[model samples]
Target: MRTLHWFRNDLRLQDNPALLAACQQGEVLPVFILDTDEPVRSALGGASRAWLHQSLTALDASLNNNLVMLKGSAQTLIPDLCARYQIEAVTWNRGYEPWTIQRDSGLKAALKANGLSVTSYNGALLFEPWDTVKKDGYPYRVYTPFYKHCMANLATRTPGVLNTARIQMVPHGEQAGLESLALRPKVAWDEAMLMDWTPGEQGAQGRLQHFLATGMGDYREGRDFPAKRSVSGLSAHLHFGEISPHQILASVRAESPADDNQTHFIKELVWREFSYNLLYHFPTLQEKNLQAKFDHFPWETDETFLKAWQTGQTGYPIVDAGMRELRQTGSMHNRVRMIVASFLIKNLKLHWHHGERWFWDCLVDADLASNSASWQWCAGSGADAAPYFRIFNPITQGQRFDPDGAYTRRYVPELKRMPSKYLYEPWACPVEISRAAGVVIGKDYPAPIVEVKASREAALAAFSEMKRRAES
Candidate 1:
């Protein structure tokens, strides 16, 4: 019997469930499609596209002689490939986005009509979003209990790791040759992006090793600091499913088992699972607020203000630095993400959707679950969101998270010469210090677009009105 392993987000040969199953079941042809209609590629920015190319290259190397690259949607391409190759079954790890659901469902129907067997597995997330549920059989909206449930009852299933030496079932593979398939990215690959990130399965494994050996123990303390390479720089890999959560969990369980850091790291992964579950259950959370009361609150649609925020000229050093980092590297520190998101949604009263879309385009690891939930969380319109009145003080946030302002210095080079106090709010520096930094307030780096004290008051009043109406 012939089998096809259709690769999607899951890009690894090691610990890959679908690939392992395909190997075990029969002769296997491994394939990936450069679908122009794929949401990831269609919206992928410079960094993401570059990373995708590298990851595909790595996957091809790992598979040795067994992989093929294809173009066209799997819905259209796979059935034809299956028919042409005389394949009996097509299998893959599932995808989660709303758009992906429509794509996969159509592919399943098409393959079935072509008289081929179609099977899929949950390998993308540690816990498939739908499987985790409250005791009452409903999905949990708040994160803590949801996290607790996930942590308390995470499945012990091991990821399918390939021992290529044990390959007794190598395929007499049939594929539309690479030239005919036309599977290259449309975006020009950015060499700078490649410098900042390592892509693919081996890269993911190396990152996890570094994190466990040096960073994982201090991850809680160091993850908040963008200046330090404290957090595992594996988000892009995880986003693309190069490393499964199960592999991460199993490795942690095997090595550190019962250590507080392992426990903490596991919970963070669970939080990611919870975010997925929240997205799965509340599919409209991307476009509509999870908290319906937020629906009544008005938001500004000011393009000028948004353009400043996007370009990192918002005049708030921390927010600007975070945005600048994103512009340069296609990723931002997690803490700063909250600070800037809150600055836009609450301080400036801009619609969360605008910032969300920009991040969607900019971040290499831009996850639908995390990005969507995080924006709404800051906006106080999502599950377990910050309270409406709990607006971030950009100056205080800069002082707290980036106490020495090293991260600020890296991205906002204009502030590198200023003192630590001035670094957090460089505009507060004397004219002489600003001059020393070669920054002329409004010219070099723009002055604060909105005064923090005034903006805080304005946001508080808006939120207060929202609460009053809700209470009434």
Candidate 2:
């Protein structure tokens, strides 16, 4: 009996449910397909492909340097590989995004048409998204009760590992070359973003070890502050499935019997799970608003505002800095992400979908679940979205999350020498003071494109009218 373990998003060898299940069947043929159907590489960026190539290269090496990397839509290529290799059964972890759901379903049918057996496992999330629902079995709309139900209802678990020694190695297909697959590599990208971070199964284990040893203790307080190295930085690893949420949750649970930080971090991981649930239940969310009322909610379709936001030219230091960080590194701090996204949707009155689409293109950490859920949350449109009227004042947001302005200065070099007091709202600096500080408004940097106070009031008024209309 021979089984092929199809690596969709889950890339790691440890605590991988699908890979383990494949081991139980026979010689595990681990494979990763370069999915072209995904829009990120084609439309807005090359940075993701560069990152993915590196990640896959790293994985190929760790699996005794024997990973089958292929291209040409998984919808077609998967069945071809199965027939050529004479695969008896195909096993893989499940994917939840609507497009993936459809694509995987089609691939499964095609494989079955060829008289192949299929097995799928849940390695993506600690809990399946749709499994945890209300007594009425309806999908969760709000996060609190959803979270409460997850905590109270789900059974306790510790992480499990895949023991390769327990498996019979497949001697055939051992000579397949990765480069023969023609997976593209190396684009003009920020080397620092890829170099500064870790990748692959080995890197994931190292990160889990270090976080549990040094970072997890203070993660609760440190996660919100950008200047603090508090976040686990496991996002891209999670995105590529190099690390499983089960491994993370199990490790956190093992370290402290009752640490609140461990629990908080686990809940955040569950937040990832909840996001996947939303995507699974409401497949239309990727393109359409979950709340249909937003379809008629007049949105200011300003490409200029979007350009300013995307290129870090909005003149609000924190928002610009966050945008710049994402442009340069393809990632952003969680808190800053919210503030910057809110600025686009609420302050700029730009459509939330616009920001979501851009993030989908840029963020290597971008999960369809987290990305869609968060953007909708900011726009007050999807399940558990923030209230429509509550707008983020960019200056106040900077002062609050990035109190010392350490993060803003790192990405916004134009404001590197500016005083911390004005760092968050440098457009407020007088021209004379700015010139003396060698900060020329139009030359060194741009002025605030929109007045913050005026924008907030306008956003609130629009929300108020929309609310009244929705209520009516």
Candidate 3:
């Protein structure tokens, strides 16, 4: 019997349950479909598409160039492929996004109705979102209980299978190549990204091993400092399913002794799971505020400020650094991500949607669930969100996290010569010091876009008005 394995997020051959299942049966046909018509939030951003192009290339090579690439609606294409190839069964790893869920459901039904055996496996997440819920059977609305619950009931997973030797490729004539998908950027903007990342299973495994050996020891404290190498840097790899969470978890548990750093890393992984849980339970997570009270909040519509924020001209060094890093490297440090997001939503009084959309386009790890949930969390409009009043002070955040200014200066090179005392707040540098440093605030580097203290007061006032209006 011929089986078809539709590759979605699970891009790797190692530890891919659905792919393994397909191989176990008979000759397997591996296929990938690029459905560009997905909803705006679900669609692949430019950075993500570029990464996808590389990832698919790597996956095709791993399959001995047997991977088939298709474009257009999967609803129409999968059945056609199955019919053409005389495939008796179809298999795939599950997707958690709302659009994918709906699409997969319809496609599954259509395939089964046509007398094709279809099976979907939980390959993306360690545990299905529905598996861990409140005792009352409702979904979790907070992180602590969910984490405690997950930790208390940690389940053992079967080891990832390597079935390459058994995977007999179903021979077919040449189809469209990976380049025909047009996933790479049309311009030359991706040079830095190419230098920064290796998008494949081997790369993901190498990253995980390197992090375990070096980064995991100090991950808890050093992860916040952007200059430190404590981060795993596996987010883009994970986003593309080049590696599995189970693989990471198993490695962490086996290789390292239990410690605060290890625990913190595991908790961070759980946070990803939590984001997926929220997305799964609340389908409108991408579009609407999970907390309805935010609907009454006064959000500003200032294109100039939004554009400034997008271009890293906000004049706040740390925030600008983060944004610039995103544009340059297709990734940003996590701590800086929160600082930049807070500056955008609270200080600028812009809607979180603006930041969300921007990150969706720029981040190599631009996941639908995590991106939406994180932006809303920063805006204080999401599940377990920071309180609206708890705004981040970008200046203090910079001094605290990037104290030596190494991380900030690397991206915001205009302020490279500024004194450490005045690095984060270049606008405050004395005239003599500014001249000595060969930097002029408002000329070479922008002045602070909005006064932080005044913006905090204005944001509080707006939040108060929103509360009053919501109550009334």
Candidate 4:
């Protein structure tokens, strides 16, 4: 039997159920299509595109250059390829995004109608969004309950499938190569990203092993500190499907004893699952407020403030550092991500969409479900969102989490010599200390764009108005 395996997010070979199924059946032709028909909102971001370019190159090399790269509409391309190759069956790992779900369903129906076998396996997530639901059969809205249920009902994980069968390649007649996708940027803006990341299955496995050895023991506490290496740094790999969550979970279970740090790490992974659950059930998660009262909330539209926040001149040391770090590295510390997000929504009074869109374009680990849910969580407009009154104070957050100022100073170098006393709040630095530190508040580093206390009050007032309007 001749089968074609379509590679979407699941890019790796090992433990890939669909790919393994294809290989075991008979001669398997692996193919990846960069679907151009994706809606603007669902389209791959700049950083994600760059990562995909490198990831696809790695995958192709793993296949011994047998991976067929194609572009344009998958709806048109897949069927055409199946017919051309005389493929007996089509297999793919499922994607949970609303667009992808719709596309796959339609494509699957079309393929079956034409008397071809079509099968899709769950490869992206540990649990299908529908599997871990409330007793009432409705999807979970709050995370704590969802986490508890998932943990209590944790199933025995199957080992990753090892494909010992030789992968047979289809004759490459005229498919365009990887470069034809133009996933890399026209300018050399990706040099820093290239230096920091190794985008492939090997790289993903290496990261997991490294995190297990060095980070997992202290993960619970050290993860909060931006300067620490407690994070797995496998977010991009997971987002790209270079590694499966099952593999990570199994590895963690086998490698570490059940401890607070291990439990916390598992909970963090479950949070990603929660985001997908929300996305699967609530398709408008990326656009509309999950909590409807936010519809009446007053959001300020100030291009000046937006630009300041974007360029990391917010004058809030921690916020600036996080934003600058995102620009330079295409990633940000999770704790700092919260700080920056809170500053944008609560302090600047900007809509969370701004932050979500920016992160979508900038972050390498920018998963749609997590990005949208997190931005909404920060804005207090999502399910299990933070309370509107619980705004993050950038100064205090910096003082607490990034206490040593190492993470801040690395991104915001003007504050390199500023004493810890005023590292987070440079505007409050003494004149003598400022001169000694060779940094000027308004000149060298920006002064705080908005006063924290006043902005907090304004945000509360806006929230009250939203409630008032919603009630009326």
* Residue 64 displacement (Å), model 4: 0.2
lDDT of 3: 0.92
Off by over 4 Å in 2: 37-45, 165-186, 468-472
| lDDT, candidate 3, 1-472, per-residue tens | 7999999998999989999899989999999999866876679989898889889999999999999998888899899999999999999999999989999999999999999999999888877999989999999989999999889877657557875876899988757979779888778688777686889999999999999999999999999999996999989998999999998889999998799998999999899999999999999999999999999999999999999999999999999999999998899999999999999999999999999999999988999999999998988899999999999999999999999999999999998899999998898899999989999888999988899999999999999999999999
Candidate 2 lDDT for residue 292: 77
Off by over 4 Å in 1: 36-46, 155-157, 165-189, 467-472
Q: Scored by CA lDDT, what does every candidate get?
A: 0.80, 0.80, 0.92, 0.92
Tens digit per residue, CA lDDT, model 4, 1-472 = 9999999999899878899888888888889999998999989999889899999999999988888899899999999989998998999999999999999999999999999999999988878898989989999999999999999877648656765446776676755989888899999798787687899999999999999999999999899999996999999999999999888999999999899999999999999999999999999999999999999999999999999999999999999999999988899999999999999999989999999999999999999999999999999999999998899999899999988999999999999999999998888888999999999889999988999999999999999999999999
Between candidates 2 and 4, the lDDT winner: 4
Residue 71 in model 4: shift from native, Å? 1.0
What digit string (tens of lDDT, one per residue) describes model 2 on residues 343-452? 99988999987898789877777777788888998888989888878788889888988888899989988888788877876767877777777898877888888998
Question: Considering summed lDDT, which 10 consecutive residues are worst modelled in model 4?
Answer: 156-165
* Distance from true location, Cα of 64 in model 2, Å: 1.9
Cα distance off (Å), candidate 3, residue 109: 0.8
> Which 10-residue span in candidate 2 carries the lowest summed lDDT?
40-49
Give lDDT tens digits, candidate 1, residues 1-472. Answer: 7888898889887877887888787788788886767665235555565677778878877777567777766677777777777889889998777777888888888788878888998887877777788878899988888887776777666667687766533354455545454333455445664676778898999888988888877776788877776777778899888899888888877766476667677777887887888888888767889998887776777888888999999899999999988877878888889899889988899989888888887878878887788888888899998987888898999888888888998898887888886887777789987797787888888988888889888888887777777667
